[model samples]
Target: MPKEQLREAAEGLARQLERQHGVRSSWEGDCVRIKGAGVDGELSFAGGVVDVSVRLGLLASPFKGMLQAEVQRYLDEHVS
Candidate 1:
């Protein structure tokens, strides 16, 4: 994806996270930093590649697979 499209996708994902998971996110330079009761992460886009790094607290660990799937689904929907 181009930088603009990546940024748009990032913003949309941020909104979805906040609305559905109560997480908050903000742009930190070229990435989106996300935080919530049991999650902390950054979503970065560069060289037409998108990367997501997440740290799930103990309370959130059990949902890891689900979270990954959701992120993948969201990216698939928007990045193409």
Candidate 2:
């Protein structure tokens, strides 16, 4: 995808996360850094690829797979 489109998708994802999950996100260089409750992560888009790195707290670790799947679903629906 083009850079502008990717940026828009990232921003939309951030808004969805904040509204639905209470995860706050901010741009850090070319990546979006997110944190809230029991989660911390960074998302980067480059060369038409989206990369996600998440760190779940002890209380949230059990839901790691679920979270990843949700993110992947979001990307599949909106980022391509």
Judged by TM-score, which candidate is best?
A: 1
TM-score of each: 0.95, 0.89
Query: What overall lDDT, based on C-alpha atoms, would model 2 receive against the true structure?
Result: 0.87
Question: Which portions of model 2 miss their true places by more than 4 Å?
Answer: none
| lDDT on C-alpha atoms for all candidate structures | 0.93, 0.87
lDDT of 1: 0.93
User: Model 1 has how many clashing residue pairs?
Assistant: 0
Indicate the residue-level lDDT of 62 in model 2: 92
Write one digit per residue (lDDT tens) for candidate 1, span 1-80.
Answer: 58998999999999999998999998987899999989999999977789999999999999899989999999999998
Question: Stretches of candidate 1 above 4 Å error?
Answer: none
Displacement of residue 53 (Cα, Å) in model 1 is 0.4
- In angstroms, give how far residue 54 of model 2 lies from its true place: 0.5
